[model samples]
Structures are given as C-alpha cells and as structure tokens.
Target chain A: MTVSTLPAYPARSARLKRISAEYPHALGLLLLAPMLSWIAVFFIFPTAWMIWQSFSERGLQPYATILTSAIYLKVLLTTLKICVITTVGCLILGYPVAYVLTTARPSTRAVLLILVVLPYWLDFIVRSYSWMILLGRHGLINQLVTGLGISSTSLPLLYNLFSVSIGMIQILLPLTILTLFSTMVRIDRRLVDAATIHGASPWRAFRTVFLPLSLPGVYAACLLLFVSALGFYVTPALLGGPEQTMISQTIMVIASDLLDWPLASAAGVLLLVVTTSLLVLYSRFFRLDRMLGGMAR
Target chain B: MRAPRASLAVNGLAGAVLVFLLFPVLVVVLISFSSVDFLSFPPPSLSLRWYRTIFSNFEWINAFLLTLQVGALTALLSTLLGVPAAFALSRHVKRGQNVVNALVLAALVTPPIIKAISIYLYYVPFGLLNTVPGLAFAHTVSGIPFVVINVVAGLRGYDRDLERAASIHGASPLRAVLGITLPLIAPSIIVGAVFAFMQSAQELLIAMFVLGTLEKPLAVKLWEGVRVAIDPSLAAATTSVTVLAILGLVTVMLAGRRARPTRVAVQG
Candidate 1:
C-alpha cells in the first residue's frame, strides 16, 4: 500500500539546473567526513581485525579451526539451544498479550501498551538487579514461600538456569508483544468475522485466518528475540551459575579474564554466523521491513 | 467492531502481562527500603538505610558519573552521524542503498555480545581498550543504528514537494534542509536521541569490554553489586536507575505527544 504510493515531485528543469550548479556534492562528502571516518576507523576496522584474528594465531593456535576443535561447536550448540528456548517462551507468553493489545479499545489499551514497552526505557542493569533481588535466596519468591509456610528452604532461586531464563524472558517479552501487536493490529477483523460467519469455530477462525496472517510478524519477532538472546551477557552472567555459562560469558572469559583474543574472535565469529544464518532463514519466510514497521505500531 | 467479550479477555490478559513484566522492577524499589542489610522483599521494617549506603559508596558515584558521560557522548555522536546518513537514505535513491541499509540493520540484529567481542578484538590493537572514548565509540555504534532508523522513517514520510517548493522559491538546498527538513523531523530526532540515551545508558556487555576498572559504567557497577554484593544497597542503586529511566521515558512521551497528534513510527 505504501511502497507504490511514493510521491515523486516532477523536477522542474530550471530548479534542477540551478540546484545542480550549486549542489556541492563535494560539500555533502565533506559534511559526511567525520561520520564516515569514525565508522571506518572504529566499526569497520575492528570488525575486519576480528575476522583477521579469527584466522591467525596472534596469541593462540589460531588457524581458524572450523573442524579441528569441539569447544566452538559446543558453544554454538549451547547458544542455539538457549536462543530457541527463549524464542519459544517469548512467543507463547507474548502472543496472548499482543492479542489483547490489538483487540482492546484504543484509549484503555494506550496505557497498557505504554506499560508494555516502558521497560525498554529502564536500564538493563537495573532490570538484572531486580531479577537478582527477586530470585535471590533471601529475595521475594523465597520470602513469600517461607511466609506461606510452604517450605523452609530458600528455594534455590538465584544463580541457576531458571533464573537466567526468567530474566531473559522478562527482557524479551516486550519485544515479542510489540512485534506481534504490530502485525495483529493490521489484520482485518472482518476476515475473522467472515470465517465465523461461515460456521468456523472461534478457535478455527483464529487458527486458519488470524494466525496465518500474523505469522510474518510472529516469525520476525522470534528471529529478533532468538538472535538477541544469543548475545545475552548481563542477564546470564548475573543470574546463571558457572554450570550454565553461555557463549558470551565464555568469550568474555577467554578475552578479558583469559586474555585470548583469537579464541574470543573465533567464538564471536561463530555466534555471528549462527545468528546471521537464522536471520536469513527468517527473512526468506517473511518480510523483515513489514515486521519492523508493523511492530513499531 | 463490537467484539466486547474478546476485547475484555485481551484487556485482562494484557493487564496480567504488564504486571508480570513490571513486578520485578517495582519489587526492587520496594526492597530498597528494607532495614536489614540483606535484600528482603515486603520489608519487615522500612528505612532509608540502603539509600544512605548507596549515596556513601564512592564506586557507585564514579560509575554513575561515567555512565552519564558515556550516555551523553553516545547521544551526541549518534545524532551527528546518524542524521545525515538518514537524510541520504530518505532523500536519495542511490545504488546499493539496500545493502547499506542491511549493514546498518546488522548492528541491531547481531547479538550484543558478539558485537562486544568483535569490537573488543578490534580494540586490542592501537591500545583502544580500557578507555572512556573507546567505550563511548562502541556505544555510539550500537546507538547510531536506532537514530538512523528512526530519522529515516520520519523523513521517508515527509512531503518532499515542500522541499522542492522551497528550493524553487530561491532557497538553497542547504537552506531548504536546515529551514525545513530538520525542523520537520525534530520529533523523530528527539525520539532517536532518547533511544540513544537509554540504549547507551543501559548497555552492559560492550561497556564491560571497553572500559577499565576506574572507568566502569553504572551497569557494570550494578552487575558487580548484584553478583558480588547482593545487598539492599544494590536495590537502592536499582531504584535510582529505574527512576531516571522513567523520567526519560515520560519526557519523551510528553514531547512526542506535544509534537504531533500521532507519533511517526520510528522502528529500529
């Protein structure tokens, strides 16, 4: 609907000529110098160097071990497992919320929608700390359970897989809701009505009509959440024990604590490959642009 | 149009989800007032002892200041770079623009940890590690993509005929841009800046890589506090950060409300 409607103001010859005479293409280049230079020096160079480091032994046996090592392979599998679980969890939790946001009255839903996304404004560290407080042995869950006379144990809440997953789910739910809401909002309610009018059950109507149409958004959101979950650092580091260490944690250990840049870069490149491949698969199934724009709604 | 029951169900579920999402943050604020040193929720006795402890901590103070500095620098650098790149994307139909867009989008799509590790490797050479400037630059990379995406969306929706009309009336391209385009997209620019602020401020993984012990950002401090200290003082710091975030969100929401009837959907 939007793409075909791009307004093309017919260029008047005189203005075009005059603008060409004084366009200062050089000036545009000059204006762009600082930004371009910064990106080149800070972003591009670093990425290139990381790739280079991945292939060479700077401080370790760095011959780009594609099939020689099992550690990177293990980290890759671990990242994938975590990401997939987080994505599925987000979908199950977020879908209902997105449905609610789309179906509710605009005025009432506005506050809820704002609340849904408000956490994005909060610092990640603060959120992690809140989880730390809530899931710690002396935190809310333990306190509540003990107060209720359910058990005397502290519940083994913090520094575990459960804590890490919960913290991640908390961070990721808003994104899933937002994306799902976008696509759901655009779904024609009349289609669902039509399906029901044809004697389809409410579930059948939704399953056949609404779900298929919203798949683009759902798939996109999952892609986003999964890819993001792959790179999680603070949540896992703060909440998870050493038994549940993620690739990001492992990379940090190798790079900073262990001082092994080659290993770190290799790990990074592995993560990048896995995430990018997933993203490509997602884009193949859905239009990323539509998902992005739709979700912003 | 009148699916009242379904709408109600949605509303009810949404309310529950919102509570679930927000409950932890609220709990932290509640726990900060506990009289005991250990974090205890639904406090047996309330006091401002943790607040006092947080205020007295020099590490917290230094980390907070450094975070502010980094956030400010991130916002500034992102705006400077992003606005023009956005302008180019919106105004011109250049070759390989899609590819350029994809690359910029990649920054957002790639896992933050991967970007951090990649940038860390990049930082090792030329001694860019453990510096305020290097950390700021890294944050800027993450933050700029948001700015560009938002500003581009804003500009894409704008009426280019207005620019044509202005230029035809003897206004130079530079004048047309400054006098018209920039002012028109001011709301998006503000949104972008706010996003940049929040993103850089909240960032933990990359900041962990680039900054040194003396230059640790607040997120790093919070991480250390939670992992090692795990006390009410950390809760106090959490409360402080939450309040600041709420303030920023409120300001942005109000500004967005005043600027226009509906926000120009600025996606990243």
Candidate 2:
C-alpha cells in the first residue's frame, strides 16, 4: 500500500506541474473570449451591418442625397461649427482651472479636482435640464435679469448657439481640465525656475519652457473634445433651436421621424469616418493609455 | 527658493469657472423643493411635495426602479467581462496585444449616437428591443471601457512578486490570483463598478432607442418630461439622480483613499 501511494504521488505532482506550465496561455484565451465575443457580436457586427445597410439598397444614392441635399450639407457644417465652438469654449474656461490645480496645495488641488469631476458623474439629462431651468424665458437667468432691472425684457438665452455652447462646455469642461491637469502636473517646475534664473521674466520662463511641453496635452484635449462634441445629441437636442441642429439630431430625425434607415446609416458612416480619422491622427501622436488614465482618475 | 504664486486673475477665473460648474446642479437641487408647480430658482417657499410626488407617482417610481435595476445589471456584467480581459491584456498576451487593446477600447471612441442607432437596428432583428436584459447588454458595451481602464491602471501599479511569492508557497496560480491579486485590486474594481453603474443610470441615448413607451428609464422619462414641460417634478427627478451621482463620486473618492495605503505598503 505504501509503495503504490508513493508512485501515485509522483504522478499527481507531475500532472500539477504540467497544468501550471500550460495554464497561462490557455487561461488567457479563455479569459478574453467572453468580452471579445461580446464586442464582436454587439459592437463590431452591428456597426458593420449599419454600414452595409447604407449601401445595400440605394447603392450610393444615400451618399449622393447627402451630398446633393442642402439640409444634410447644412447639418454637417453646423455640426462642425458647434464642435469647434465647444472645443474652444472648454479650453478657455478649463485651462485656468487646470493651471490653478497644478499650482495649488495638495489639499486644495484635491478639493478643486473633486469639484470639477463631480459634475461628470451627473446624468446628461439632468445637466441639460439644469441648463434649461437657468436659460428659459422665465428661468433663473431671466429672473435675475428682470429682478435686478438689468433688462426690460428677458434675453433669448434658451434656444440658440450660445445656450448649446454653454451646456456642452459645462458638460465637457471636466474632461478638458482633467486631461490638461494630468499633463501640466507632470512638467518639472524646476525647468521654469531654470529659465527664470537664466534672466527671463517669470511669464517668459513659463512661455518658453512650460507652454511648449503642455501643447501635447492641449492638442489631445482639443481633439478629444472636438470628437466628443461632434456626437452631441442630448445637449444640442435639448438646448439648441432648429437652425442649430447637429448631424446627430439630424440622424435621429431621419431614422426615427423620417424612417429612412439607409439615409441615417449613410450619415452615421460619414460621422464615423471623420471621428475615426481624427482618432487615428491622435494615436499617431499620443498614447491612448495616458488619455484614458487621466479620465479614469 | 519658492515658485511664484498664481496671479489673482488666474485664481478669480478659476473660481468663477468652478462656480459656473456647480451652480446649475445646485439650482436643480434647490428647486426640487419648490412650493409651486413651476420651475424656478429661490423658490417662493420650500416643500417636499415634489419628492413625495416622485415617490408616489407610478410612472416616476417605475422608471426610477427600472433605472436602478439596469444600472446594477450593467455593472455586474461589465465587471465580469472586463476584469478577465484586463488581466489577459496586462499579463498574458504577448502577440497582437495592441490589436486586442484597440478592439477593446474602440467602444470608447465610437459616438454614442451611432452606437444607439446601430444597436437599435441590430436589436430589432433579434427581438431584443425594450427588454431589461437587452438594455443592460447594450449598456455593457459602453461600461466595459471604464472597468478595463480602471482595472488595468490598478494592475499596472500592482507588485507581481507577491503573486510569485504565493506560488512559491505552494498556491496554484489561480489560487494566488484569487487570494492575493484580487484582494489588492479590490479598490479599483469597486471604483470601476461604481462608474459603470452611474454611467448606465445616467445613460439616455441608447435607452431612448431601446426602451419603448410602456417601460422607460429615469433618464428617458426626464428627457421626455423636459421636452414637454418644465415643472418641479422634473427638478425632483433630477435631484434624485444628482444625489445618486454624488454618492457614486464619494464612493470613488473613498476607494482612491483606500487604495493609497495599499500602494504605499506595496512600495515599502
């Protein structure tokens, strides 16, 4: 009995060793299969099907319609215009906040960072609703204006490019600040001091030394904001007027209201092209991990 | 020896921007207690009537419950899927890692509107529209990125020697990971789960396409309400969401704090 058990122990140990040796490779594939399959089925396949549907029946007519029709062309241009506005608006409002975050004490920086990011957790519908309450005719802004005798009549603040820009900027400002702060915090302050010691003024030291280093962050933020802004659906839909209609809203209208799947798919494909190209350009310059890391924090 | 302080103008600008960011959400919270029916700031009188209404109204209550269910389901599914993929990406895969990474993160860059339309079309053929599970699955696509990103960041900072130590002590590889690795990364997993839940809760675009009139999430209900009317009830609904969001943010902050000491211990 003892001799038989001794031989079985060696066999069992060998089996364990073999399992350990071969496990990681097999395990990795097993681990990845679920998510990879889910994405392929739900995301990749659907996107491909949509693209195929675009040309399945009309055979380029939808593309021609988009190119030839005044409405589609105008909507595309308006979408671009709004995206540029949102990107610029976020930069102007967010840069100083990020700069201050980098310069502040750690406690103050933590508080400030929380303030910027807290809004990100709130729902877009709620944020957009808040904007409506503030910008409506008898809303908060008008109430303040009227109560203070600042204007005889309420300002048209609710449904325009200005309102859309404000709402979008507010929504995307946190992303801009976080991205900029992540990069700005990494710049060695001693470099600026080195420049100042070399006889440059304080502002000049920053301009020459720090600003160039921060450009990569600014470019990445703008690209991210611009691409994100291009996909504005809720904010623009809730805040903007007819003339301010974006391509996303146009697509929804086409798909749901007009019931034109092919036309909607064509427009979606067009939006996809522009966004993917910009992202490809971004990937060429900056690592996506850095951007995602900044966001996750 | 000290750096020059940020100028007064910069501080003031930043302060103003912070105020701009906080004021709207604050107004929504404040207006939810309005005594009157209409939406207004600095309400004539404060009351809990809207909150009571939200709790009592069937439509509002149903939507809120549905939103919570979907959020929970989405968080669970994404984590189960994302953690393994994150592990595979960070540890095991040697070849085609970049391709896999790109594939995983692709959902992050895809516009939500495009996702909504395409998924809506895809679901129609499969009869997946308007079901809670279907909605959760649709949301899981977006939720995967948050979980993967947070978990990967957590894993990057993790000390691999600890796992090897466990293995040397006669633990199987799987046992080492379950007992040693996962416990260390629990904070990240929590943060990821919270974000995924909040994202699914607040999501409206895909929900709008997938859900029908009979069953709606809070976001869709609020959206439909805002477009049609501006009332204290909408403010009440918005405030409830605001509270949930604040709670989620606090959880993440606490998770970050909890993660710090473990990291310090690992380094030391």
Candidate 3:
C-alpha cells in the first residue's frame, strides 16, 4: 500500500522524497498494518461482538439471567475455589523447590532448576495424559494395588477433583517455583547469615529473614497462578468429574453443545473480567523478562 | 560448604517434588512400550509395538503433518507480524503506546476458552473454521506477545547509535532498520519464533474450536485418544510431541546463551 501510494517517478520523485522526509515514522506505521489489521479483524472485533451479544441477545437479559441463576453462580464459585486451592497447592509444593534452587550448590541448583523448567517446556496435554494413564482403573497404580492384594477394587483416581488438582499443580508448579526462585535468589544471603549468627534457630532465620524477603515472589506467584488457573480449560475439561466441572467447562458446553452464544459470552465475559484484572496487576508490577529468566542465571 | 541439616531436608523434599512433576511423563513413556493392549505400569514386557502402530496409521501421520504445517506457519507468520510490531513499540510514536501494548499482548491475558468461543462465533459466518490458515491466524494472536517481549528486550539492550548513524548519513529509516537493527536482534527474534511454534503446537482448545470437519491436528488427535482411553499409541504421540517441545526449548536456551555475548559487545 505504501509503495502504491508513492508518487509517480518522473515528476513526482521530489514530492515522494518530501513526504518521506517529513513523515519518517510513517514507515513504522505502515509496517504495523498487517498485524494490527489481523488483530483488529480477528481478535478485537470478535471480543467486542461477544460482549455486545451478551447484552443484545434478548435485550439486556443474558446478564440478568446469568447473575440470577444459581447454576452460573455455583460454577463461578467452583472456578474461584479451584483457583484458590490450586494456588495454595502450588505454594506448598513449589516453595521448597524455589528454596533449594536459591540455596543449593551452583551445580546442584542448575540441575534442580532445569528439572522444573523441563516439565514446563513439555506440552501440558502430554504431561496431563501421563496422569491419565496412571489414574485410570486399568492403569499402573490400580494394577499395583490390585496385584498387591490390598484391595479388590481399583481406586477411583480418574475424573475427580483430586486428579485434576494433581495435574494442574504439576503444570502450574513451575511458574510458582520460577517466580519465587527469582525473588529468593535476589535475597541477600548475608541477612540470613546475620540472623543465624545472633543465635536464632535456622527456622527462625528463614521465617524472620528469608520468608519475608521472598514474599514479593510469593505474591507474584499467587497472582499469576490464580489468574492462570482460572482459565484452565483443557486439564479440567479432560480430567475433571461431572460434579467438578469449572466455569470454563460450563462455557464450553454452552458455546458448543447448547449453542447458546449469549450465555457462553456472559460466562466468558465474567472470566475475562476476573483474569484481566489480576493479569493487569501482574503486568504492572512485574517484568515478563524476569518471569522467563528465572533459570537463565 | 555443605548445606545446613535443615537445608538438606529441604533439598530432599525438592527432589521429591521434582519426581512428582516428572512422574507422569515417565509413566507415559514407560506405558508406551507396554507389550499388552492396555495401559499397565512396568509393562508385562517391553516392545516397540505402539510406536509401530503410530507409524502405520495414516490418521496419526496426517494429524502429525498438519500439526507440523500449522505450527511452522504459525511460527513464521507470528515472527513476520510480531517482529515489526516489536520494533514499532521499541522506537515509534510514544502517544497511545500503552494502548497499543495492551492490544498486542491482549491475547495473553484473555482465556483461551473465551478466545476459542468468541472466535468460533465470529468465524462461523466467514466459514474460516476447519482451515489451517484460520487456526494459524487465531494462534498468531497468542504468539505475538512472545515476539514483543523478546525483541523489545533486545531493543532495550541495543545501541541506537548504529541505526541513527545509518539514517543520518544516507540510508532511509526502513533501510537502516532492515540492515542495521534487525541483524542485531535476530537471536531474540528466533527465540520468539520458537515460542510461537510451541504455543501453536501445544495449543488444544483453539484447535478444537477452529478445526471442525477438517483433519484434526496432533493436539486434537492426542486429546481424543486420551479421552477415549489412554492407549500405548497415545503414549507414543505424547512422547513425540514432548520430544519436539524439549528440542525447541533447548534451542531457545542455547540462543539465549549466545545472545549474551552480542549484548556485551554492544555495551562495551
């Protein structure tokens, strides 16, 4: 478009030069057109329409229906509950990993850190399927239990909150560890040493010195994890039980199975509001670079 | 020096957590070699029978090929579209820059399910569903943020003097950027490209919505396989994708390592 808009060469070369000199930033603007256009047409337009459709469908009634409906509120509550539980689970599981990463010998820390990052690099679905194999009745855990003669029946490990949580905790565990580890690594080790020298116990040194220092990482991790966990569709949809379906699963059913775009859009708008608010907080205070570079050092 | 006793205990617990994280993948790999028809741990006997099944199956192969095609194109397109936008954000108009930044990275915050549903509703009339180009376009939205982040980092660390020198002497702004700036940030761009590939290749929900009636990609295929039953062949598929993901990540790491030297040179 820029090329075509250029003035015809013979008499207009001066004019073309004048325009280019005057508007140096125009090239940059021209460069952005393809991506901006695509995003506008595909992403922004759809999102705007979705929000509008939620209100326009039956004339501002979808919002009322969703807000008033017990089923919708229950699903929203389940989603929030799951997000809280998953955040807590990640903290408990990830804190030690981050602690070790900051405290271990360099060689040992690198290996330990890589182990966490390695799982994150894998496809979540593939990693999740690993749980699928282990949790099913015909799976190994069951085979072991039955073969050991401890129980006559296979454990109901699949399609439950426990299984879903296990899978998500594993997937989300890396993010928490990486965030907390970055913060923990920055903590001045001498402060903990200073506390130890004053006759405080090791636990006291950690609680009074280290834990408080690393709280930012914990905050960052919790905010990032909770927001991310809220949007989890694949793992919960695949691994969760009928009773354990989260808001995302409900949205999927409404969108595809029920063909209720208004209801689906309403659910989605709710999810978007909650997640975007948390994420805006994250993006405001944190650098994406640090999030990725936890192990780079 | 050896760590304190309590620290050693913490390290041991960390090891166990790592095991918990990696245990499922190891189980999947082991079960893939199961000689029996069903998934049982410590297989009755080891065999390559499942891998053989994937190799023999056309559906599996087609899905793999389509995944590769879509993933590669998504990577390429995201890079082309994203790198320029990154450049713009790095040194362009300051007004409305935050607005543009939010718009570009919007895909990251929005739930994939929401994107999938909204895009599906939007795409039905356009009949863009079930096409590789359609899926790639949807995926590119998610991938652009990686380029913006990585390349913007590169730009932040770069010396603007070189581009400025080129433009002041004789070169146009476009030439200065294309010739002087791009090569300096090429490594970051590559990392962004790899990220784009991984984002698309691992993507499932969006693929599910956009690829109706069309041949499913490996992600959809893998999802269907596991949902129906976790078989040895599904294990093989997961293993293949995992291997590819690891390979991609390792490339980014190596590139990042190489990136340090260039940055040091610029700083010096």
Best by DockQ: 2
Point out where model 2 deviates above 4 Å: A1-29, A146-150, A292-296, B1-6, B245-268
Worst 10 contiguous positions by lDDT, candidate 3 chain A? A1-10
Candidates' TM-scores? 0.85, 0.90, 0.84
- Please rank every candidate by lDDT, starting with the best: 2, 3, 1
lDDT of 3 by residue, B146-167 (tens): 7767787788778887766664
Error of 2 at B210 (Å): 1.6
Question: Candidate 1: lDDT of B261?
Answer: 34
The segments of candidate 3 whose C-alpha lies over 4 angstroms from its true place after superposition are A1-38, A105-107, A143-154, A197-200, A294-297, B1-3, B85-105, B152-187, B245-268
Q: DockQ for each candidate?
A: 0.40, 0.46, 0.42
In every candidate, what fraction of the native interface contacts is reproduced?
0.44, 0.51, 0.51
Better-scoring candidate (TM-score), 2 or 3: 2
TM-score-wise, the better of 1 and 2 is 2
Ranking by TM-score: 2, 1, 3
Extract clashing residue pairs from model 2.
none
TM-score of chain A of each: 0.82, 0.88, 0.82
RMSD of each: 5.0, 5.0, 5.8
Selected candidate, larger lDDT, 1 vs 2: 2
Put the candidates in DockQ order, highest first.
2, 3, 1
Using TM-score as the yardstick, the better of models 1 and 3 is: 1
